[model samples]
Target: MTTETRPPAAPPRVDTSRRTRAPLHLGWWLAAAVIGLTLLNIGSVVVRSPNLDWSVVWEYFLSTDVLAGLARTVELTAIAMACGIVGGVILAVMRLSPVPVVSWAAKSYVWFFRGTPLLVHILFWYNLAALVPAIAVEIPFGPTLFEVDTNDLITPLLAAVIALGLNEAAYMAEVVRGGLLSVDPGQTEAAKALGMTHRQTLRRVVVPQALRVVIPPTGNQVISMLKASALVSVTSTPELLYSVQVIYNNNFKTIPLLVVASAWYLIVTSVLYVVQHHLERRFSRGTGRG
Candidate 1:
């Protein structure tokens, strides 16, 4: 061995084949097959349906009434979500307050609003004037600024806004609270160390940081709100779904008008998806999520 030695012989190469693995998954394949077949069956049924009326869908897609309804839907969504963001922020702040009364009131609001169905909320708003006949702007101890009938102030459209907005507030309150909670406690301490007041720290340091956590869920809520806005039809608001229903009620082209509504919703949702995607990309900079 000493006579034969040159440099130490290189160690034999280890085989890596044993490290490679891909077992056949019969269960996975079977599940995939079932899903594929189910999708195909549904597609076939849609293609063969007798009442689809794709033509009517196309014809009324941009009709005046339909467009107006779509506009109203957009308006409601904007107003509702805006109100939601504001009210949600307030409720979230209240929820985290040091005052027991404030915190309890916030908790109760979230509980009731989230617990009740949105449709009931909308209906109640529509009929709220029956419960409280008048609304006023007054200084509690000093002066009555003005007064008006609740029915006059809360039209069907206003009712829709109030209902959807307040209901959305409850859900959004949780979202906002979660986002705020996700912020590092260290950040708040650091802000305070810099002599920042609580409001200043929240507004300047906490809220901006928390928004990255909040935007995705808020966007999803907006989409859901869009769909839920249709429930306002129950209040006889002439928004998209209600408008479609009115048309179908007049003409007997029930499926066709419904198709129009569906098409519009699809278009709006697709636009929202694109917008949300861009927003996510914008916000996900350091996180590398899209």
Candidate 2:
């Protein structure tokens, strides 16, 4: 029998008439246009203002005094953050402890520190010498075992470090505790079942997993800590803002000096943002948020 070849069937047509176009809201376009124009106008005014003195800004931006102040700011940030991270971990552990008194004490510490402003902490540490002329170590109701002049121990730099570090610890403890809590309860239970001690399980399994949750906020705190280092200028700690203040105080070029300080802050914060993004991506790898 002869086989008949059938003609190829025609391809189906797309339903173009039923296709939907995304909505175009004229109000959104108009609002965007208005905002863009407003920003351009403000920028033009700032860029053209004669009193801003770009020359003065450039002249002192990398001056010796300013560089020294920038170095001080970086040093303080590193040291303070280190202290805060260590103290925060300890406080977070204490806060999570089963012992009622330990948890309550940690809570009280967080409450007191968080309730007080960082500026107050700085001032308090700076003026500690006034409150107590000497720092003493001794038996509670007995003779002093050791004593030292408060001023000798608590210099301006030391005072700034103590203030910034302790204040950061209060905030960081909450961040760490949140991270710890995000960890799955089953992970802890499994580790314990495998003969791991509580501390061992926490250090190995829980903390490693918790890092993914902990890192983003910790990075933000680092950037904030860098900016907050400016507050140390109150105690004449010679950080970035204080250094510029000295320049403006002598030359009376207040706005330009402030611009220089702001420029440095922006540059450093930008770098930190990049680092934080990379870290978040690295930690979020399998989770798909990356």
Winning model by lDDT? 2
| Clash count of each predicted structure | 0, 0
lDDT tens digits by residue: candidate 1, 214-248: 98999999999999999999988989999999988
TM-score per prediction, in order, is 0.85, 0.88
Error of 1 at 255 (Å): 1.6
Candidate 2 lDDT by residue in tens digits, 149-195: 99999999999999999999988999999999999999999999999
TM-score of 1: 0.85
Task: Looking at model 1, report the run of 10 residues with the lowest lDDT sum.
Answer: 281-290
Off by over 4 Å in 2: 1-24, 139-143, 195-200
Best by TM-score: 2
